[model samples]
Structures are given as structure tokens and as C-alpha cells.
Target: MLVLWEIYPWRNVEVKKSVLVVLVVALTLIFPLNVFASVQIQRPVYVEGKRIAFDISPIVEKGTTLVQIRPLYEALGLTLSFDPKTREVKGGNDKYEVVLTLGSDLAKVNGKEHKLELAPRTIKGHTMVPLRFVAESVGNSVYVNTDTKRIFIGVFMTYLKDKYFDMSWGLSKEEVSKINKNDHNELLYENNKFLFYDTEFSLASKKNMVPANKIYSFEGNKLSGAIVKFNSSDDFDEQYSTYTQVIYDLNNLYRTSSIYPYDKYWIEGDSIERAYREVYKDDRMKMYEMAVRSGDLVFICPFDFADTELALFLQNKGTFSKPEYEVSIMYEQNKEFFNQISN
Candidate 1:
């Protein structure tokens, strides 16, 4: 089992709170703890898919990734403001806002309190704050590719922000066919709702997953969803381990812990055999769900926002002895699906 630090923000959450507070989700991560020197930024930071050039450059002091406060805020669409009198910095656009003291670890987001593992400070005439804290606070995703030694931060609310594979969202069949002219495996479903491309998918640039089917689901001849389903004939333990890693990967890239509060499951014993038999079991003693959600903030406030759910799932279709594991990442982009279905 890949051991992890209990540093995830939602890990300490109580079950009594059914709804995961936004503040907690903002701080949730399973980052490896390691200290380092105040060297020049070895890893280049990319915000919203654009590489940011800083005068002083980003520095990693004690394992925390710190960046120049102003550029980082503006990249996230937040206008930066500072109060010299109080040593405070404020940044916001309209819906999202952040206020923090120069030397304090406490931050205020939309009038709610959030704690940073590292405090904001001045380094070589530039103010620096924990990069992960600010990005994840306003519903953005942050990931560091150790292989590439590059930092990727996405300012997103749902589904990678208008990213739908090689094609953009809301494209017609004619538009898609022109963009991706490569020969595909499958053409159409019975009802002509899906188009499949038998290809591999790389999650957060970490692992290359060879999927059984990479599908593009359509609604009214317009692209509505992009899905990748994987199948494995591995044993129960191996399959379960792979599934959890996938979930953790997506958790950082998408907003989930706020809705599901992942700590509730697998807190006591994370081993596959124990978790499968003990916590997740059916009435027939078969198995509980290994599938978890990677939905956006739409899950928290169903009435307010359109729901774009990046649903991640793992299932043991066959028995334990001859287990047939099914792992899938499904994206359902239904703009008004919530409003139409709800009262």
C-alpha cells in the first residue's frame, strides 16, 4: 500500500458535519512532506495553463510552495490590494475574495476563515504566500509533476474549465469529426449517443491509463460528456490499490472532499481486504461501492450552479478469487440538469 501523511485537510473532519465546509476542501491535499533550501524556483509554476514569470521567482521553503502574491492572485482572476497600515493583503473579483495578513497564516475567504500551513511573508521585496492554499481556496486545482519537476495550477470550477479532450465543449458532430480526423475504433451507439476512441488517458500527467473505451457522449448531437473506462483482470488487492490511487489523483484535480468527505471511509483500515469486507459490503455480503465522485461545487449548491461531475469509479464485477475490476472516469456536463430535475 502506498502510505500517505494524514495531512489532508478533510482527514480531521467529524462525521457529524454531513456537508464538508468549503474552507476544509480548500486545504485538502496528500503532499509528501520534505524540507528544502531557499534556492531559485527549480520547478516552473503554470497557472491556468500559462507559465508565470516572476522577478524574484517562486521559492520552496520547508516543503511549502510559495509564489509572488500579486501575480498569483491576478492569474486566478483576483484583483490584488494591500494595506500597508495593517500589513494585510486583499484580493477578489466579485464572487470570490481573499484577505490575509502579511505575517499571519490565517486567511479569510468570502468572509469565512481558512488556515494556511505556511504564512505569507516578504522575500526579496516580494510578498509570498503558500501557492497551494490560495489556489485551492477559490476552487482551483494544484498539482506538481515530480517527473517533469513542473507545478500546474488550474483555476477551475468544473471539468478543467472548457477543456474537453482535444475538442472544446458544445461542439457538434461535424465540428468534432473535423478536429480529430484520426481513425477511431467505434463510431456510434445504438441510439447514436456515443462515439468511442480506443486510446489511453493520462491522469494529471501522472500515469498513462490504457482504457478499454474512451467515449464521447452527445446530447442533441452536441458533445455533452467525455468518458474513459478501464478494465483489469488483477486480483482484489491490486485492483483496489490502483483504484484508490486514481481517486486520490482526481481529488487534487477536482473538488470532491467537500461533497463526499472522503475521510469517512478508509480512515480506520485502508487495506483493500479489510476495507472491502468490513466497511463496504452489501446486504448479500457481496461488496459495497468503490466508486467515488469528483464533482464541482455544484454538488454543494445544486440550485445555484450547473453540475459538471467528473465521476470516478472502481468495481469488482467478478468474484474476489477471479476478480474483474472496472475503473472508469466519467464526465457528465449537464448545464441545467440540476435545475430541471430539482424542485
Candidate 2:
């Protein structure tokens, strides 16, 4: 009985150990360790107030937001290319390029290597990349809302300025009003829907006095689009030369595609003359038009399709010449809105 009592202590210890093991196993079954892992399911992503309808929902892992590479790239007007042999994805616009490799935590922005918190991986045949790392790397702004589970990617607006005037998209009405009031050398025209500023500065010869005018179209209280007009003398050949040079300069500054044989109709005395024209496409400009008149050359560029309705209204109001020389440049991201206004 004495021997049994001494051995009983060892037996009690074994029983306690077994209970501890069993409790651990049971607790593990109740709540797996993976439950504590930082993994979030699909969430919504927005770009410039527009929702991106991605085929694969973005996931959050290890405190990083991972998104499908293609949809987000194309949504932001950036071109994306993948090399199967290298397993590398390259995306960029005219100004920046981002490079990412599958299962790599390192990314390159314009040849500068940047460390990523989580490596990009292929999920269900889609390449998922860290959104914030790639976005900010290319000079875009990335914002995440935890409570709403929404991610926002913002592209900055292009601003064009000169001695006479400064212009950009998304400008406030008050800002436009202030500019209009301050500038005395230019004639300013404003209404509830549009603001037209004619700059006294001219690119023409001294005899021509061809003024440059800027038009700003508004939606609610925000600027939606802008146009800079350079009125030329009544010389079609000279106009054609100036147009070619401007198009060449614009194409050099931006990535463009040329659409040839653009047909135009003009009334000549008793009949309409059909003329074929060519236009350079700049999809990054959102929507743009170059209208040529007897003494006017108009360059209309919109920052967003939210101004499409206003643009069509201005066209109907005869603010510019007939739509003969108009070429609208729209990106695929604005296809739905373009179609809505086009029809």
C-alpha cells in the first residue's frame, strides 16, 4: 500500500498532464489559430468617386489590402502587361511605371525598389497585389476606410497655367470666381453653367490679334471640363498646319492613338462636302475635342465624364461651332458614362 501511494503521485501527475493536453486540443478545435490571422474577405474599392466592379473582390492580409492587378490598373487609365516567362507584372502611365513579381515582397516604381508588407500571390488565377504599395508608388493617393471597408485610389488632376490664366479640373466655383475677378487683362464670361475667360494673349502674328480663350464648364459647384481656344485667321491651309503641329506636340506629351479617315461634312453653297479628317486619341484626357472654324481653333478637354451632360448641353447652345471638327477622347473606365451621353 505504501508503494502504491508513492506511485499514485506519479499517476496523478500523468492524469493532470493528459487533462492539460485534452483541454488544449479541445480549445484548438473550438478556435483555430488561423482565426487570429489577419485575413479579410472581399471589400469594395473606389477610384475617383467611381466604384470598380472587380471580378475578384479585394482581400486584406497582414494589415495590407491586396487587389486584383488588372482591374485596378485599367480603372486608373494605366496600362498593365504581364510576362509569363518572368512572372512579372508591369503597370504604368506616361509618367510612372510599377513592376511586381508573383510571390515577391519587393516592388519597383520607376526602377526604384520598394519593400512590400505582403508579397503578391496568385489566387484563383488572379494576381493579387498590395494596393497601397503599388498605388502610392506611382504617385497616386491611397485611402482606406476601416469602418466602411472601402478603399479609395485618387489620381491628381492635371493643371495647365500660363501668364494670363491658370486652369485645372475639380476647381471650386469660388476659386473660379476669384480668378475671374482678379484678372483685368482678360474678358470673363460666367453663367450658372459655364465660365468663359478670353485671354488677350495671342499666338498669332501682330496683324491677326487672335486671342486665346478658356472655357470652364461646371457641374453643381465643381469644375468638370475646360477648353482653350486659339482663333486663327481665315486661312484653311494655315489652320491645317497649326492643327498638325498642335496634334504632334500633344501626341509627344501624351500616349496617343491615331484614328484616321475621320469624316466631316460641310455645307458648300448648295451641297454638303464630305471631308475625311484624322484625329489623335488621348484617352487619359478623359474627353477632349478639337474644333476648327473659319477663325477659331478650340481644344476642349474634360477631366471626368461627370461633365458629359454639361458638354452636350454646351454643344447644343452653340457655344462652339458644329461638331464637325470635334473628336471626343474617352477611356474605357468612362465607357458607361460616355455611352449614356453619346446616345
Candidate 3:
């Protein structure tokens, strides 16, 4: 899991003392301190399709579900600390901080005091907090299904976003053909090594009055790469700038670094010529490659380097002219795929 250090702004408000006392009394009577042993097993909590096993199971009090603090917080890559003297639990990263005191409706997030719907409390030696409040506070969307008695947290992906269109990933070729029936250009090629989808997609370019034709590639039922050919009339500098901006936006979104001078290499050619190859990678060995040649910019990453090397050979042929460059933003799917392959 990536550690999100982005600080989320939270508001602070004062709770009426009388209202706090009445709420505490009602909760105490419903969920007595000694009743932890008798409490039945509750519905499980899932984060992004994975079940979370808590040391002490989640419980309900006054219609609000409460879950153990350490397990859930740590699972989200946040550090948690507890102070027995003050009964305060402080957790979060440098970007945001959460401070909750036992049996107190008031909590401090980033040093700003805010009112919690239900005060955090200890149950059977484990600290429990309001499930919805804590989960949503850390940038996760929470959904409760009363019919199934289950809680699901995080975004579920339905389609993969590409430069021109949102394509369906993890779906078989036949499944895609059903929905993309109008796209007569859709072609499939397969061998013992892998399956491929060659579909023509078009997007507006600066020099072309009409949208230029681009072919998007799918391997193993996933949108893996794309080949964008640019018209000779297009300005080279403008195309480079456009590609650079796309790289910048991808870096910002994925929190990954763009290919820098230190990571760049040039082939034996004119000194004024730009490096034809660039690679973007994180510490985890996940890679994305961009190659500019002839009039085309070919992109392939998480695919073998041999594929990228073949692209370099094709670029050397100069059959293509100024290539339209666009980065494939598949950070989430790529991360998931890389982990599955590595493990």
C-alpha cells in the first residue's frame, strides 16, 4: 500500500456538554463495559475486496459499528501510537494526524479539535472506534450493505481509462466485442506467448484538421500499450512539449518520478538529438517506457524490455513521422498486476 502523506483539512466544532453526557449514558446502558465477552461475532470488514481480520471483532453500539483501531489503521499504512496516561490514541503520517481520547466525543485531527459522533472506547483491552468515521476520515469511501451485513471500503474499478477511451480490462476478448460491436476495426491476434487486441482509436492533434488514427494494444486481456503516429506537418517542439506535460501529470497522479537526465541515455547520433528512450520506475521495480523515433512515440511498460527494444528498432526505420505521445494512466491496475506477478 502506498502511504498517502497528503493532509486532509478537517473542521473543529464544540459539542454541548449536556448532549455529550446524555449520549454517553445511553451508549453505556446499551453496550455495557463487561458485555464484551457475550457480544456475538459481527459482519466482517473488507478493504478493496480483501477481508480484514481484527484481533477483537467489530461490534455495534447505538446503531453505529465500531472496529479495532490498530489493525485497520496499520493496514492502511498509517502509524498509530497510544498513551495510557492520557488515554489518547494518535495515528497518521506527516501529512495528517488523528488524535482520539478514550470516552471523549471530542477528537483532534492535526491539532484541531473536532466532535466525533461516538466517543472511542476500550473493549476487551482493544481500542474500538466508529467504523465509518475513521475509514472515511483517511480518504476511503465506506459502504454498508444491511441486506448482506457487510462493509466495503475503497473504489472498485469497472473500466480502464486510456487516452482516447475507457476500455474494459480483465474481460475476455469475446466480452469486449459484445460491448464494442460498432468498432469494426477491432482485430485480435494471438499465439502461444500472448493474446493481442489491435483497435484503431482517433484523437485530435494540433496539425491534423481531423483526428489522427492511433492503434491501441491490449495484451492478456489488459490495455498494455499504444502506438500513436504523428503527421509530418506537426511541429516537433509542440509534440515534445505535449508529451512532457502528459508525463508530468502522470508523475503527479502516481507520486512517481519522471525519467530524469540521470536515468536517460542517447544512442550514437547528433549531439543535438534528444534521447529516444525514457523509463519511469518506482522503488518497487514497476516500469513504464517511452520511445520517440521516426514520427512515432511507442509506449510499453510492465511488458518485457524485449518488446520495448523491438519498438526502438521500428523507430530507427523512420517509417513513421512526428508521433502523437500520450502516457497510459494505469497506475492502479499496474500496481495490482505487478504485486500479483512478483508474489
Count of steric clashes across candidates, in order: 0, 0, 4
Best by TM-score: 1
Ranking the candidates on lDDT from highest down gives: 1, 2, 3
Against the unseen true structure, what C-alpha lDDT does each candidate score? Answer: 0.56, 0.50, 0.46
Give every collision pair in model 1. Answer: none
Report the C-alpha lDDT of model 3 over 1-343, residue by residue, as the tens digit: 1111011010011111111111212223346453332233456676755568898777776567789988788766678998999998888876778888998889877788888877888777888988777776666666554333557665433443434334543555455445555543444544332333444433333343322223334455554433333322233345444444444433322222212311222233334133332233232111212334443233222111100100111112233343433322222133433332234
Q: List the residue pairs that clash in candidate 3.
A: 295-320, 295-321, 295-322, 295-323
Quote each prediction's TM-score. Answer: 0.41, 0.39, 0.39
RMSD of 3: 18.7
- The residue-level lDDT of candidate 3 at 253 comes to 21
**List of clashing residue pairs for candidate 2:** none
Off by over 4 Å in 1: 1-17, 21-73, 76-167, 183-191, 202-209, 258-307, 319-322, 334-343
Worst 10 residues of 2 by lDDT: 14-23
**Candidate 1, 114-141: lDDT as tens digits:** 8887778777689988888888777766
Q: What's the CA error at residue 3 for candidate 2, in Å?
A: 88
